[model samples]
Target: MNRPAARLLTFQLPLAAFLVFLLFPFYWMLVTALKPNRDLYNLTVNPLWTWTPTLDHVRRLLWDTHFLPWMRNTLVISVGATALSLAASLLAAYAIGRLRFRGSGVLGITIFLTYLVPPVILFIPLSRIVSALGLWDRPAALVLTYPTFLVPFCVWLLLGYFRTLPRELEDCARVDGASRFQVMRYVTFPLALPGILSCLIFAFTLSWNEYLYALVFLSSTDQKTVPVGLATELVTGDVFQWGPLMAGALLGSVPVAVAYSFFVEHYVAALTGALKE
Candidate 1:
């Protein structure tokens, strides 16, 4: 083979291998979720295609656990946290990115830095605050705690995206006798929809998948989001229920995967972040 052809093969081989390696586990989980207990324990290799696929695990996941309630709780906390963070971060990022103020740079840095704060340090204190505020042992604890991370991360992410947009768009709106809020509502926002969507998806997924604070704060069975609730089930006994657990995990990840793919599909439709102003 020619040297260039050989180099191409070397690179392509590794890339293909890496992709297969990453995808194989997801394939296995789907396979496992579809397989009967007997086929699963039958001691087989290449279980993906070898097993007699069944929907029993999926059935049990929906019927056996409080799966719907957990999903609802997750949706509640995720949507609430995302909406709250989106509103607050939009205003804050706009101020920091488009408006001039003394100490704005320092405040922006501080907001970004808040994302790096470990939940371990803050959860305990926040739990106390939640108790004082009468939010303990409820899904509200998650809503409250999630903003600690979501607000900062969204603010930072949107700050960069907002900074890249042309100021002339808002300028034109003002010349048309639009108020600040009107410019944001009618012009600036239309231009920044992509960043807003991205932040919404990011913050929602983060809050949805959050386990630490939810596990620490929420005590009610009906109030626990899917992540913490599923984890609690994973440790009910010495032997883990790997089948149902994987089944639940499979279902749990679907929304997030759909959201990511949806965002990627329409990534170019918005005028922020990935857009070149």
Candidate 2:
């Protein structure tokens, strides 16, 4: 084979296959959501494509179910968790990365190690904490608990990014009679915007899709997040509402997709900066 043809076979073919593999789920979800029950259940009909597409599932998900409320609860919880995690992580990362303090290196390592602890294990103790605090079945429960996992990862990422930044700029700000808070506000924080945005997106996505904690913490229909709401309400023992379930899943993923589409460049840049140190 010619060199160009070999390159196409080795690179383009694999790339195309991977793209299809990655995208096939979304395509399947869309098709399943649009398919009528008759076409959906009929083994004789093509499963990949539907002759009759209907909006009944979407309509049912929006009108018959509490999907809109679930979405609102999810949005509130995700935003709250992301904001709280980002604020705490920024302070923790900056102090560990920039300040000369005793055991700062150990502290940073310890924080990152916490991220490795399985969330499934923490959820059990967290359930007790949430109930003790009277936050169970409330969005506040998730907002507070989500930081257990989110803060550690965010701090680690921010610490690396902070290390990559030139410390001289911070020193220069301090020499100009600026306070620590002022230096952070005007100098370090501004430079660290990309990393912050990356952490925000990550935290939001995790909070949005979180299932175990959401399932355990929230029992009310109106208080549930998208993931929990869809799973519990759309499936009844042996029966699965496949159409509405797929519709919910497709809709639930849209916010995260839009978030990545908007800030993907910054996310990549942040990861690059963090990896530099």
Which candidate tops lDDT?
2
TM-scores for all candidates: the values are: 0.90, 0.95
Stretch of 10 with least lDDT, candidate 2: 268-277
Candidate 2 residue lDDT tens string, 62-175? 999999999999999999999999999999999999895999989988998898898888888999999999998989999998998999989988987887789999899999
lDDT (CA) per prediction: 0.81, 0.92
How many backbone collisions does model 1 have? Answer: 1
Q: Can you write out model 1's per-residue Cα lDDT over 1-277, one digit (the tens) per residue?
A: 9988898799978898999999988888787778777767766555566436767778877888887899998998899888888889999998988887888989998988887888888877887898999988877777767888889888887887887789988998899999999998888778888778888878877887888888888887777888888889655887766678788889999988888788875443432443332
lDDT of candidate 2 at residue 220, scale 0 to 100:
91
Q: What would the C-alpha RMSD of candidate 2 be, to one decimal place? A: 1.6
Angstrom error at residue 86, model 2: 0.9
